[model samples]
Target: MNCKQLQKIENYHEGKLQTEELNFVKKHLESCDECRRYLDELKSQALLLSRIKNFKPTLINPVAFRNEVLDQIQSKRNRYLVVRASRFVNSIIFILTQPITRYSFITAAIVIFGVFIFQQTIIVRKIESLEKRMGSNIVAKESGRPGRKNVDAFFKGRMEVQSDSDEAFRELLGNYRSLQIRYTVLLKMLKEKYPATYQEILKELEEAELLPENINI
Candidate 1:
């Protein structure tokens, strides 16, 4: 309430007040609810700061550590779920340092490697079996086809082409389609930038039946 009382309160906050001054302020605060509230607020704030200053971090659940160690020991452990390791930096190292943990990790790794090698061996055997089956089937199919004619001068040293006209036409059509696409692209560019060249190539393609006569660009 008074200037002297307020000065004493400030001195109390600063902690530089004499014993006599402290005793006087304590007496004044007993009769004054406002100063008492003010001191309580200050004490609460100081208590909070003191708690912060002397804070002791809590440990993670021991069950979680045990579960994490078990996860690492298992061969089929999830690589993404590293929940406990992130909390404690040396958890993995601590787990690995123990003789049991070391043996478990090595055993798990060996089991994983063995399974991988077993899978690879199975795959290699399957591939070899497939290759053998394919080779036998190919030989059987090849032997079923017509045999080659005489190599003598019976037909003026000319033997018939093994591939028929239909096969030849299909092959020719496939090659022509690729050539047609390239020529089409070139014709488009020529049509815009060089009209005479475009007309010549277009005429050649149409006459060769590579493109339809009435086809739109």
Candidate 2:
């Protein structure tokens, strides 16, 4: 077992584990020699610690001690609050102004891309709906059913719909291909220039169990 798992054993043996969890830990300790040893070491430590006598405070001057602590606490609070407030003010200013400057350009780019994607999706949906409607109408007219439109008009509409569907597909393919290229370049630059930060990201991913156990880096 790892250190964290061993720590949990002490928590479990001390009756701190919840009901369902206690049962699982009990069952695990029965079969896991590593965990059993860890629990034994913790038990030994607790036994040794319990035999030691506690020291009583001899200062007796409660007011002086309290005043000193209060002074130190106030100094720390002032430092912490000033730093925190400065950061908070800076972040607020950036939020209010950066969008109109740096982020306006990014927003415009995203909007342009989003408009293309939205158009593609709408066109695709419309094409599907139109195809179904036209197919049903064709079948009805062919099977001796009434309420059929002019054949010339129907053919012209079908051609226009087919052309639009093909154009939408082409546009979507081009847009996604460009997005992938841009993302790949950005990721490559980030990984190369900020390798330590990238490794930290990878470590977080490993802790989340996203990385495989055999992964080297």
Candidate 3:
């Protein structure tokens, strides 16, 4: 059959065609097996759809259904969070309660204390060595001078004679300035790290007139 005649089969089966067009498609289908098969397939599809349309769906409130799903999801999330929090707390408590943890903490503290003591000891030794060297130099230079009345006289004579040479005096001044810079830097670090000790040192320096009374650190 022609495409136009085949296309009218659906209209014929659905009773949408005029009486004359219906009769024409009916005659064409009888003569053409392809058109007859197409009409049968279309009728079967329509019948299946009609049966599906006849079914009545069970109704539900969409808002309530959506709220119920959301509530379930929120409840699950809350339970998960609670479980995770509980696990974290339990783990912390477990570690804190363990004998090994306590021992480790004590060991760390002891090690830190020992390190601090060792550092202080080294610094004290260095200071003492520097002082001894300076004293020995002054003593050796004054060995020829008899009747050195006291330590003050010896130091005064040494200081007076040491500046006789311009080059040597300049070198001494340079070393003194360098030492002063280093001391200032160290003092600044100590002020930040140990405020109490720094305060005591500052007070001593101010009393001795080594540091200005109005200086903060």
Best by lDDT: 3
lDDT at position 41, candidate 3: 92
Score each candidate by Cα lDDT: 0.57, 0.58, 0.63
Model 3 lDDT per residue over 124-195, tens place: 555444334443443343343333343234323323333345454334434454444544554675566657
**TM-score of candidate 1 against the unseen true structure:** 0.28
Scored by lDDT, model 2 comes in at 0.58
The 10 consecutive residues of candidate 2 with the worst lDDT sum are 155-164
**Clashing residue pairs, backbone N/CA/C < 3 A, model 1:** none
Compose the digit string of candidate 1's lDDT tens values, residues 59-112. Answer: 679889889888777734444346455647677677878999989989999999
Task: Give the Å error, residue 45, model 2.
Answer: 50
What ranking emerges by lDDT with the best candidate at the front?
3, 2, 1
Off by over 4 Å in 1: 1-87, 144-217
Scored against the true structure, residue 173 in model 3 reaches a CA lDDT of: 33
